[model samples]
Target: MKNNPHHPYHPIIYVRGFAATQSEIEAAVADPYMGFNIGSTKTRLAWTGQVKRFHFESPLVRLMGEHGYRDVFVDGNDLVAGDFADQPIPYQSIIVYRYYDEASNDFGSGETPPIEHFARGLNKLILRLQDKVCANKRNNVSPEDFRVHLVAHSMGGLVCRAFLQNKGLGTEKARAAVDKLFTYATPHNGIDMRIVRNVPGWLSFGDANNFNRERMANYLDLPKGDDVSIVKHFPPERVFNLIGTNSRDYSVLRGASSWAAGDASDGLVRIENATTHGPGADGRDVTSPRAFVHRSHSGHYGIVNSEEGYQNLTRFLFGKLRIDGILDIDNITFPAELDKYHEENRAVRASYQIESAVSVRKYPWQITRREIRENSAIFRTYDQLFPGQPGTKRPPDRSMSPHLFSVFLDPEKSCKASKSVSLLCDLKLLTPDYEVDGVLFLKRHYEGGVIYQRQILVEAIPDTNAAGGWRIKYGDQENNPGKATLVAESRPLGDGDPASGLVFSIPIQQKSRPGLHGALRVEVRPWS
Candidate 1:
């Protein structure tokens, strides 16, 4: 047997359910206030049916199994049902769960446990999973090498946030192990399920007697209290969030009358709660959350089974396949409405309104030109500069000096022009292909501008570390006359010099190697 070096030692373990515990039922049934067995929450029963019928099918099992992982399905209600210590190593796993209950119109009665309490229980479950994986000698995966990505429907997202931000979760490394999290329709803020009228002290599932709106508010980490805000605490890089939106209505209250503004929802969870909160910072958060749209909510029960939901689940679990830095969309642009606004207000704004007479209006123009500066026989090599000699000038047919051109900025590196006046001169080179050369004009462009050239060289540098870049030295070009004269020109019609073109030729240099490439830099001089 052979294992790849990049392979992880510990398999991914999935945990399922906000399951029922015998103790809770025994306590609820024994209470003097209740006459009959209210039983477990309807949501749990619904989830149980869904998981048995679809989530544990051959397709899903085979999908995860092929990746060298074992699906460890634990009963959320049983608490100690699944094998906590006997899971496969170096495989992806799952931990499925559902809401505590479907609270009927009965306030101050038996209700599901508090979400934060459930979150604490989940932390314990994770620790146990880690302990089991560590015991296997074949498991070489460290805590850092492994990651747990969560795929939750409805209330699952809230549970995840509580786990990360809760003081009980301990240090950052523990939090980091959970690399990605996708919530189907988690309500970051409280949902408008109308619990106020039905269940008395509905939010007080953890502690019954002292349960009040204020105390429950503290447990839920509302904006009012000191409870840690998951959004504020967790960085965006570690989480992946998804949301489901639909027109279906499942609200038993007021017959779907104004269910969180009524227009968009997955029948229960609103679209507003599907993705992360607010007009967020202009960036992505891998850790905190991300969201995607779905046509249907799958009736809450069928969320994990439907085609759209499953595809999203798999993509969220696996890292997006990279093919030239694109995913789902080829390219995205700002709304056309915003673009129109900017177009209408293209003029530079003064501190106050500037006078129309004082401000100069601008127009756009295009220019093109061609020239033959050297004989084909003498100019055999590729390294040549255009507009090389003296008294050679190209008319300004186009010019847009006021327009700004900014450099590219990325996380890997940041760069700006070394000088204020960064110039980009595009020069075309003509060459003949060896295979069929009656006289094929192989045109190519080179860039050079007066800003801040790092080294004083005769040739131009490349923009990226791709193919086709040349840097000519002072002695590289042939100086002997009767061969070819290096000529450069420009054509700016409206925003640039018109009739601007360049031509130059150099003697072909024979080399033992197949290809020749080098670099050069121009000296930086302060602008006057």
Candidate 2:
């Protein structure tokens, strides 16, 4: 069947993560789907501390059941190996990139190959899939139109990046065939430990040097000073990073890995290192779309097996609408005593924290969450926000402002009765404690205080006649629960093209001495 323009369902290639031990490699080679079929039976409710009976039937099964996607393996035989007389496969099919099979003793040589070999293997696999998929003339898919989505976990993301970024590793045709890339708990910036810092290049046990930044720079073909997360060859906007924040649940090494990786990690990959960046339309390096879930790195409670991960994966692969949230700060007020202390020219240091929790209306779980308690809140220093003018009341630089969350909404997945997409952003700006001359100023300080907090609910009602193609309405859920009474018309940003999207600004202010004045700027655009 021909793919829909609005909701294109392309073939998905699952790339499994790293397997350090020989036994792990053998186990990975044993599984037909390479752990992509692992599912979870229970989930912890955020609002209530109850263990819910939510069953996520794995990404493989869910994709097959929900979207009518099929697997390449049929009747215990691999179709990619020419098992069924060159039978044509459906366009919406799942193919597991079993790169580790070559490293296993049961399948091939016992020696593990480098990441470049895996990239080359991925290139060959894409070409083979292209041949198999295009063989079906009834599907009407040409070689130029054939595309595939890369869904990976952990170190697998690096392999995909190697194929796309390293020109010498793969052909341009294979790179062009990638439609979108989604990663789960990938250490894009390289792994860091409490004592070890960056994994040393000399650490060759189980080829642990693969997580080293120096090795990554070599495989990813990144420049000396450039970050490994920067996507030079591929369209970075099409990539989605799904970060996990629950380090406590990661049982790797009997929880030793989590302790060493610290609290701001997903038990393995640090939160700050889990995202990717690429050049935006304005030529500035912008962060790709990412979401944070309260899951572990890999295990029974791993990111790949969670519902939050699957939901984000399906939406990014097939969703039609995209929304980006950013906070534009006009001014951050200080306490009266701190204001006097700041005017005295004594060194006063203060840093602000911005916490955001996003979810669709009627959903029980948050799509993206960054909270102070979770240790994943966005932090900014006083000088960083207001460069060269620390104590001044000047507005923060717009470029330095925090990008809260990027969410993709599928209109087809919306409530059948309402038929509208509703997004709720629970934003909070925590008040910072002041320190004068390296001394703590706790005169009137209270623990767990916020300068600004609100629940802004936005509803996008589809309208063909509307200027921006949607009727927008907003409401402060904290003040009026479950109501969207205020009308917010969409205004064009830049040239007003559908790709440029429409901007909707919601004014936010506290007006108190220690307050926050800003606008939560939301940009909505049509996404494929």
Candidate 3:
């Protein structure tokens, strides 16, 4: 709405993540598309060791085919030169930051600049893009349509944040030019290892200060003692984060890095730190939309190169219809005979593993998480909602929890091209009970933490006329075999039905399991 009525398919600026070593930095700078052009052949061999062979081609190529966008690299030059040189740069184009060029053999004197300098360079890059793409000419798009989406990885995310947040790091015009920002495995809150995740006070040499919370705060101009999650300059909603949960695969530093970072990490940045601040500096409780992928930071199973990452990236930038699915938790039926323990502070703690696969003929799934691994498709319900708090003056609108995840349904990507958006998903419910006698009792795989998995179908009919224009439908796929949906009702906006809005209930009919027999809702909205 700010610019054209299009799905905000403005230019994209690729920002690659941190290069730990000089060799790594050089490798990062050497690529014209930074790592966007890179492709992976072996994308997670299936259970049978039979490789699924998901050739993504590359995000760069897909953008061209799926969305009419071109990369601004010709022959060997990073950009066009000399008065357009008989050929003008296209309006909807993609450009890599080439930020580490100074340190690469092909460009500068092999000296890497600090993050602040890289950030300032980003501002300059945006302005340059404005001049090239937005200026009036034959195929010119107006300055109003000049906004660019920032697709960044790792420390590159911080660079974008710095440009927007750190005072004087970038001009207001440059900042406004950034319409949407998407990051894959970006350490938004700052990196941590083992328990010593925050950068040490003494290790101030080299680029180590880059991830240091204090240093990052100083460079990003964050208020003293505040975490980097809090954002003030930019709208939190415009940002999207793709989190990598597979740690065993992130073999950087020969597994030392992964081991140190430990559980619930992409093997470097913990899941907690992988997203932007849930609440901004102003205490606004503004959280960015993010999706968890079963990928590493980088490599074959990396968040950048894999199908899941690319699917998320393309849909977010180009997808016309958006749907969000959530569970309307009415009741959590804890295992009976265990209620006596509830008299004390001890109670059953449950975590829900939500794994969804977009059912499309052309592509297997934009994203897929079948089972619950440590950092995988599992979205935990850590908040304790006990049976005791029922009639005790409950908070307003307390029935719904945060959305499980947002599924961007692209018309072009869909085979049906927007008849109805559907997601075939399975939710694994795990109850890791509290320590009975002082011995902690929650070991994974070997059997202690994990519990249940439920399969369901979530659907919504698109209507541009209604607010959010989504007539949602959901049901238990496994339980209700014949019916397309158990709940065939439409969630139309402005109706008095609690399910009318973006958030609609999914009645969990797993009565036999004696597990949490409650209904969940779907919260669908436009992300772009």
Q: Candidate 1's residue-wise lDDT over 397-506, tens digit each?
A: 11211111111111111113221111221122222222112332223312221111111112222223312111112222124311112221211222232122111222
Q: Estimate each model's TM-score.
A: 0.44, 0.95, 0.85
Q: 1-528, model 3: which lDDT tens digit per residue?
A: 254533377878888888767788777766667788887877446679886755767888878887789877676555632345445677778888888888776678777788889999999989888887655375446665668889999898999999988867999888887888888888888888776758775665548768888877888788656477766688886788898888899888799989998878888988888878544545667667778877888887788887788888877777766666555555555445333443454643544554444443345554644245555554544353333452243332453353566667765444375577677665666554434335444443334343446666776666676445665666666777423455444454334453335656666665643355556566666555
Candidate 1: misplaced stretches above 4 Å? Answer: 1-59, 65-68, 73-90, 97-111, 169-173, 193-217, 220-222, 225-230, 249-261, 277-289, 296-302, 320-528
lDDT of 2 by residue, 1-528 (tens): 244331278889999999989999999999999999999888456557776678888999999999999998877888875646556787888999999988999999999999999999999999988888878776678878888999999999999999999999999988888999999998998999999898889999888899898899999998755378888788889999999999999998999999989999999889988999988777878789999998899888899998889889988999988888899888787788888877876788888889999988776788899988889999987777777654556557889889998999989877686677888999988878678899988886788888888899988778778766776779989788877788875688668674457888878778788888888888888887
**What local lDDT score does residue 266 receive in model 3, on the 0 to 100 scale?**
84
Candidate of highest TM-score? 2
The local distance difference test score of each candidate is: 0.34, 0.86, 0.69
Question: Can you give the lDDT of residue 396 in candidate 1?
Answer: 22
Give the Cα-based TM-score of candidate 1 against the true structure. 0.44
TM-score ranking, best first? 2, 3, 1
1 versus 2: better TM-score goes to: 2
Order of all candidates by lDDT, from best down to worst? 2, 3, 1
